[model samples]
Target: MITEFQLLDAPAVPTVVVKRAEVAATHLPELFDATFARFHAAIAEGVVAPSGPPFGLYLRMEDTLDIEIGFPGVLQSPDENLVASELPAGRIASAQYWGSFDGLPLAWAEFVSHVAGQGLSVAGPCWESYVTMPEPNMDPTTIRTDLFCAVS
Candidate 1:
């Protein structure tokens, strides 16, 4: 199911991220799997956490190492390596979707439709936050994800 689009002033939160020059669509699954693993491992071991799945995660792009990804309170800025912030604040246009990441295009279409309907435009690249582990054996109909577009 698709969710109503909402423009929210999202609070910053701690995050763990990996940088890539270009993430081709063909590699999304592997990228997501590895990233999700890092996030999950952090939470499970108390290195960084919400005690469970995150409400969402942010993906920011940069031509240089000048990037930041973060969660609430804690922020990290890496130099010359595509900085990953743990806390950064901004406006977010978000939507929630259930089922596997394979259906992400549908959700993106929905999100795009919602953004247009609201007369707002997406400001940056999209981010997909896992609400459940990415297990190949899991039912595709049961996975949940929160998709977000940064708002300028």
Candidate 2:
């Protein structure tokens, strides 16, 4: 997939998140599903309205990955396990990926390379904006994810 490079002035996003450290790749789907369900439940209870697509905010990616999976919205009385947080706003490099989530690593790799090609440096943890929800029978090609990396 072709990775497009662009700059974004992202605003602070109020979010409800499920944080996990050293998460296994195989467990991601379930974690995301559970997190979304909880967030959706909050919405069902009239806690908050959805303001943006679901996102995976990566805090670390070394021997283990530390991340948060959640939805952005206006703050509400979150449940015990959910915490309200803000996505920092600043200059970033981004690209839209039109394919399965499985292809994300490749897209990110290209996006990073593209950023470097432009003489920019990554300054913070990367995040993925899940633009399209995937269904079991859905075509993988139809999925869309917007990737972002804070840059200096």
Candidate number with greatest TM-score = 2
Q: Model 2, 87: alpha-carbon shift in Å?
A: 1.3
State the lDDT of candidate 1 residue by residue for 1-152, as single tens digits.
Answer: 66755788877655544455445556655755565566555545555534234432434433322222222322133323223345335888888788777787788788878887887887765666666656768788788787777676
lDDT tens per residue, model 2, 1-152:
74566898887778777788998777788988888888788789877666889899998887678998887876566577777877878887888899998888888888888889889988998999999999989999999899888899
How far residue 31's Cα lies from its native spot in candidate 2, in Å, is: 1.4
TM-score of each: 0.67, 0.91
lDDT of model 2 at position 71:
78
User: What is the alpha-carbon lDDT of model 2 when measured against the actual structure?
Assistant: 0.84
Q: The CA-based lDDT of model 1 is what?
A: 0.58
Report lDDT (CA) for all predictions: 0.58, 0.84
Look at candidate 2 and give me any clashing residue pairs: none
Candidate 1 residues lying further than 4 Å off, grouped into runs, are: 38-88, 134-137
